[model samples]
Target: MSRPNLRVNAPLLGARRSGPARLLAAAGLAAAAGLALPGPVAQADTASVRCSVPDLVEAIGRANGTPGADTIRLAPKCTYTLVTADPGSPANGLPAITGDLTIDGNGATITRPASAPAFRILFVAETGDLTLNRTTVSGGRATDCPLFPGEGVCGGGIYNLGRLTVNRSRVVHNSAVTTVDNLFAEGGGIDSDGTAATVNDSEISHNTAAYSGSTPSSAEGGGLANDGPLTLNRSRLTDNTVSVADNTDSFAFGAGHAAFALTTIEHSTISGNRVRAVGGTALAALATGSPLPGQATSLSMTDSTVSGNTTSAPNGVAVGGGLGTNFPVTLTRTRVVDNTATAPGGTARGGGIHIGRTGDLTLKDSTVRHNTAHAPGGTARGGGMSSATGGTVRTDRSHIRKNTAEAPDGGTAQGGGVFNAVGSTTLTRSSITDNRAVEGGGIFKESGTVTLNDTTVRGNRGNNCAPPGSVPGCTG
Candidate 1:
């Protein structure tokens, strides 16, 4: 959506002035010294190629072979639509990047028409480092990528094996599908494997990754899949989804869209993202992953908002509607609210947050409220949080309130606010209030070490503690 009159930002202007713009600004000074400079004097000389409207596929093909980290400047106010002339050829969409490249959209858009085959708009190879500025990558569907034919499709918009940088741009409405049933799909918008991706001041929204058939399907990172490091700064990820088939042992991750590696998010908003599976053995939504058996996967958020993200499998156990991790998660000044996990045929746990087996969760100055977990046929546990065995949860100066855990089939509902099972739970100056459940409305402590120092439990619908003696100031 950053079209003509995109309003040059200070960072973009500053980048130009410092890098290649020096060739012009300093030209006057060089001319005074009677020195003639040929071109950009950067480590790898910069090349700028202007794109033609309907021939962007060829333009991208040419840019892929550029000598160095060059720039491709598109024509102002143009939307390049790519179509396939040959349906059988694997070389259909834009060519894969073979070298370092930077695309300056200049208010243009890159998209493939619906008539084209299911091809991604981009492929950043291992040797290709891409920096996209002021553009949009939309409506790409990677159904069959010839490079790795047997593997399930990935990176509907872009597959990055090298470094990727997106600034002042948008990646939306893309999809990654399994050409053949039962395969895995990942990163409907972008997939970064063993690399570093930095997306700032942009929007990645409305993307999906899915599969069908009686066989199993696995989906990760609906808007993005990161098996490497990923950073989102001042960006927004909204309304993305991953739909996996039922009756499989599957994991649907990152409705707001992130995963598997160290992820750092600052001043961003991830809302209205979802993962809905038909019926799987176990389904973890929002974000799902575990570190090496002994190692830990980390998700760190600062001053961000994670709200309205959901996890639901029609006939499977649903966990972590807002977020889930098998390792450790650190949230500072973040808001987690209004997330839900409802299992029509199975049980639901942790409508807001779920700490997997062998996981650790921490929240500092954060708020988790107004979440719900429902089990229509089975048991519902932990409306706000559920920590499994060997898992620990810690909250410092945070609030967990007004969450609900329900089991409509006359099952069991425990811990509308929090549940600790064979895990250590600690609260320092936090409040758990107004939670509703069948047993231990405020907290269900079943064989865990619970220590509440300067914490409050009041106005819960049922008992405050499961055993009535595990927590101080709580009586059944």
Candidate 2:
């Protein structure tokens, strides 16, 4: 009898053994009989194929089967717009790019809908390193995805669950909104969950997190939210906002902290972000809930700039303006300027920066200036900076000046330059001048131990009702 011909499906490997198995055996016999294979077998080290959006999308979907054989290179000046038909299922939204794909924009922009759910764009879940150079990922909405709440409604621009290297790219105007009550919203622009994300000379700005129904709790990073070791080298985090109640509540919201577990910011700028709480311009006034139960958040800035940020409370009450709960913030070769926390009744303190509640803050080779705490009825202290209630602050080789606190109703105000309260403070080789406090003038100490070495306190004015024997330095 004549041998029967078998047909084999190469792509259907590992499913089941049937006629295809005999076909593979026949193919092996044919190969041994000096017959070449029909399909072109891809070899290793093949050049990346330049592909369009559709081609690239298809390649990503087939990445699992193809493995290391596929590489899609995007065209220069081409823009890819991703659209999904189903609102609930974002998994069916866009193609998953795996297998060493290089989708270069060539200085082009990728535009997506700002109202679409998260993961509607490129999903980099593969192990291959994805690089976006000189590209712009903008205008995506991360909201109300029932399919994948955690991963879907995050990183509206590009959801990177793998290693992402973004160079000179821009991630802007992205937002994550919560539909269900009590669920936290996070990462307006990009959400890196324990991924190795290196952002070099990039800009993450103008992102937000908006929650729904009855003062929903939300944290908008306004840029990038990372739960990993995030390194921002020559980057800018600007104009982020977190809305919550004022009072000690807002400090715990974890807005900026959402972007990183451990953040190392060098030669960068974190400015113009708003934290709405009870006390005006005070992060301590918000009801955001702290990262640690009794401890504040951690922000370490070196050779960077944090300026033009605003923290505001409701109408009444006075709390931390610049920083919320203190939380071990160390600043070296940095600048914190032009920040304000305004409270009614003139009881606001720490207009520029607020150190509170066993929080430890240290400033070395830095400058804090042009911050204000405006109060009318009660006392307003620390025009430039404030420390309160078991908070410790130490400054070395720094300058604190040009801060103002206006308390006109005869309430005692202190520390136009520096305010130390209920904690230990040490200042060395620092100058505190041009600060006006109604009571202590230059340096205000209340229930704390202060040691000043090689420091100058001058040109500060005490108000009319200065405490009996209290000048700028020695108060009674």
lDDT value, candidate 1, whole model: 0.73
lDDT of candidate 2 at residue 397, scale 0 to 100: 98
Per-model CA lDDT versus the true structure: 0.73, 0.57
Model 1, 1-476: lDDT tens digits are 11111113111000000111212333454456476445554454344445554355555566664555666777775777767532323433566766777888877788877777678887776566889999899888876533335556778888876678999999999998763555667788987763578999999999988765455546667788776678989999899988766665454566667576678889998889888765652333446455543333588989988788888876777777887766578989998899887787677888888877756789999988998888876778899887745588999999999999998876788889998888888999999999889988998888778788899988888877776787766665
* Residues 1-476 of candidate 2: C-alpha lDDT, one tens digit per residue: 11111012111000011212222343465467576446666553322324345554555566534634443445566666655422333542455444454545566666666454444344556244566677777666665322234422455556555567778878777666555544445566776643456788988777765444243233434456654446778888777665533332222122342322445668887777665545322342111112323322355778987677665554544454444443466779988788766666636777776766645678999998888777766677788777766677889999988887777665656777777777877888998877777766677776667777887777777732134333234432
TM-score of every candidate: 0.85, 0.74
In model 2, the runs with Cα more than 4 Å from the true position are 1-52, 62-72, 85-103, 114-129, 144-153, 158-162, 245-260, 278-299, 316-326, 344-349, 375-379, 407-413, 463-476
- Give me the runs in candidate 1 sitting further than 4 Å from their true place: 1-55, 85-92, 144-149, 281-285, 293-296
- Clash count in backbone of candidate 1: 2
Error of 2 at 202 (Å): 0.5
lDDT of residue 347 for candidate 1: 72
